[model samples]
Target: MIRVERVGPLATIQDLGRPGWFDSGVGIAGAADRSSLRLANRLVGNPEGAAGIEALLGGLELLAQRHLTVAVTGAPAPASVDGRPVGAASVLEIEEGQRLRLGLATTGLRSYVAVRGGIDVAPVLGSRSRDTLSGIGPEPLRAGDVLPVGPPPRTHPIVDVAPVAAPAGDLLTVRVVPGPRADWFADAGALYRGEWTVSSDTDRIGARLDRRSGPTLDRRGAGELPTEGMALGSIQVPPSGQPVVFLADHPITGGYPVVAVVVDADVDLVAQARPGQPMRFRPC
Candidate 1:
């Protein structure tokens, strides 16, 4: 068992997420940065989709009740085990009573921590992901929580370290495709016209961007669109003329008009962007 001693801004157990549940109104709410999660699991010798910790802006601390192997990825947060510095993307060993700690991340918004055996939290709707929008799966991690470790897989860890680039500090650009309702906007190109700034309100639900340049997005079709299924990365434009890129925990359906959709690969880029980060959308 691993005991959570502190969880900073936010922390939750997550896997790849529950797909095929949108018809039932459940959105897939896995790790916001899926690539980082997969890397963390791989470094620890767990399956790519194994459940792990998604620590927001870092500050996660855990204690090993027994011998354990673990790895941390994403955000490039400085890590220490019992006050000794440890590499973030390298395999780490924690003995009984040893504590693993992560400080505030210098870049990126979230980090992933994986144990050799994935987190064995009780799954809800076939996933351990905590949907911030729907209240699904286990609740956000709290101090004193004890997380069970799953049985080790047949394979042993082969990778010692993964040298991933830290999330970018300057303006990050992502590619996008037109949305189903692109015609609803008077100026569909408004999205790509500006360098956007991530809003402070951004979370697992979605990333709301503030226009740093370019024209406001206005809807040509005034009447409200009936509630329709929303996909992850859909750039929905609400009445405020601002575009919001839906994230992992976004609602299954929404009534707003979607003007653009970020490409699947770039959605991971959006996930790592912190508040106030500059962003650009390029039409593919």
Candidate 2:
């Protein structure tokens, strides 16, 4: 078990997310950077889809109630156990009553922490993911919360350390596939040409882009688009003319036309993009 000492700005338990529940109006609410969560789980010998803690902008501190192993991944951050520095992507053992502290991210926006047995939070809808948009699943972590850890796997930890590239850069290039409503726009090619800036309004639901100089994308169809199911990477353009790239906690349905959808593989890049970062879209 572990006790949450500080929850920072936003921290929640997440797994692979509750899929196949869209018909019931549930969005797939999983880790923003799923690859980091999976890698952290793997390092701690937990199942790939095991529930772990997603720490936004770091600043998470925990106290271990018993001996266990833990791993931290995503957004290289300063981590320490009892004041001793530890590597971010390496496995570390925690003794009873010891405290683990994660500092602000040096490069990325979110960091993942995985315990050996995974966070044993009660699941809702077959997943432990917290849907920030719909207020489903567990609430965000708070100070003094006691989080139980499940039994560790019988098999030993596979790797001692596995470092990944830091998800930070000045410019982020995302590949997109033409969306079903591409014809609604006057010039679909303009999306690829304009250099958009990640807006401060970005959140788990979507990343809003600010195109300062280009002409607002003119809609060919004047009528309102019928409400339809939305996907993880759906780029929905609202009346403001700015594009919003849907993320893990996006709504299940949207009324705006989806101009394009980011490729599945590049969604992680979008997740790591910080506010004010320059971004460009490319057709795949």
Candidate 3:
């Protein structure tokens, strides 16, 4: 068992998310950077879909109630046990009553922490992920919360160290495929040419991109179009002319026109992109 000593700005338990529930109006609410979660679970010999803690911008501290192995992945952050520095992306053993601290992220936006046995939280609708948008599953982590760890798997951890990419540099080039409503916009080509900056208002629902000296998209369709099913990574353009890239917690359906959809390979980059980070879309 692990007890939350201090809750960071945002921390929540997440698994692979509840898929095939869109018909019930539930969006797939999982870790923003799923690749990090999978890697963390693999480092600790847990299933890829095991529930773990997702720390936003780091600063999470926990106290272990029992001896267990843990792995930290995603966002390059400083991790320590009882003030002694520990390595990220590698498994570390913690004794009973030891305190584990995850400091502010030096790069990237979200981090994943996986215990050896995985977080044994109660599942809701076939998932342990918290849906911030629809209020489904467990609540976000708070101080004094106790997290139960499950029994360890029989198979031992395979890798000694797993290296994962942290979001870097000033500009991130993401690939986009023309969305179904692409014809609703006057100029879809401008999305690939414009260098848009990520807005501060970005969240689990979506990442809003600022036009920043580029031409705003002119809508050719009526504003009252019927709501249609939305997908992850769908770049929906609002009346303001800015594009919002849908994330894991986005609405299942939206009325806004989708100009393009970010490629599946690059959606993780959107999760790590910080406010004011410049990005360009490349249509493939």
Candidate 4:
């Protein structure tokens, strides 16, 4: 078992997320950095989809109740165990009562921490991921939260500890494909080719953007419709004509028309986007 002595501003347990639950009105909620989460799990020999802690921004202090092997990845933060500096991307042997501290990240918005057997939490809707939008899954972690460590698998395995590359800067270029309602605007496609800034209101639900001067959208007779299923990368345009790119914890449905969908590979970039950062969309 592990106890959270201090939890950063935002931290939650997440895995690969609950897929195929959309039909039942369950939203897919998981680590913002899916690739990093999977890699951290692989580094600790945990199942690729095992539930782990997702630290937003940074700064998390944990105490191990028992000896455990752990790994930290994503957003490259300075990690230390028992006052000894540990590699940010490699596995470490933690002894009982040892304190693990992760400082603020130099880059990226979220970081993932994985244990040997994975965190044991009651799965909700077949997922341990927390849905910030729907209030599903486990609640966000707070100080003094003790997480149980599941039974380690029978077979032991070796793992590589190569560091994952960090993103260049806060400004990320994302790939977007034409959305279902691409024809609603006079030059809808032109928006994708222009540059925009991520608004401060961005979150797991969606990222609002600052629209640049371009083609005007036809709002006449285009009133909002009933909420419909929203995909992971769907970019919805509200009546204000501002584009909002959906993220992992986005609402299950929305009424605004979707003008574009970010490519699957680029969705991770949106998770790291900070306010006031420039993001230009390009055709996939």
Which predicted model would earn the best lDDT? 1
In every candidate, how many clashes are there?
A: 0, 0, 0, 0
Looking at model 1, the pairs that clash are none
Model 3 Cα shift for residue 277 (angstroms) = 0.7
Local distance difference test, per candidate?
0.92, 0.89, 0.90, 0.84
lDDT of 1 by residue, 1-284 (tens): 99999999999999999997887888889999999999999888899999999999999999999999999999988999999999879999899999999999999999999998899998898998899888989989999999999998989888789888999999999999987898998888888887999999899999999989888889996689999988889999999887899999999899999988899998989999999999998998
Clash count in backbone of candidate 3: 0
Off by over 4 Å in 3: none
For candidate 1, the 10 contiguous residues with the lowest summed lDDT are 213-222
Taking all chains together, the TM-score of candidate 3 against the true structure is 0.97
For residues 182-247, write the lDDT of model 3, one tens digit per residue.
888888777887699999999889999997656767777665569999989999998888899999
Q: What would you estimate as the lDDT of candidate 4?
A: 0.84
What's the TM-score of every candidate structure? 0.98, 0.97, 0.97, 0.93
**Cα lDDT of model 4 by residue, 1-284, tens digit:** 99999877699999989988888888887888788898888888888999999998779999999998898988877899988998877988899999999998877778899998999999998999999988999989999888999998765557557656785465578988886877666677767665788888887788898855445444446566677888998988888877888888988888888888998888888887777778888876
Better of 3 and 4 by lDDT: 3
True-structure Cα RMSD, model 2: 1.2
lDDT of 2 by residue, 1-284 (tens): 99999977799999989998877888789998899999999998888899999998899999999997999998887999999999879999999999999998877778999999989989999999999999999999999999999999987787889967888577788999987898889987778886999999988889999995556676776788889988889999887788999999998898998999999998888988888889999999
Task: Point out where model 1 deviates above 4 Å.
Answer: none
Show the lowest summed lDDT stretch of 10 residues, model 4.
Answer: 211-220
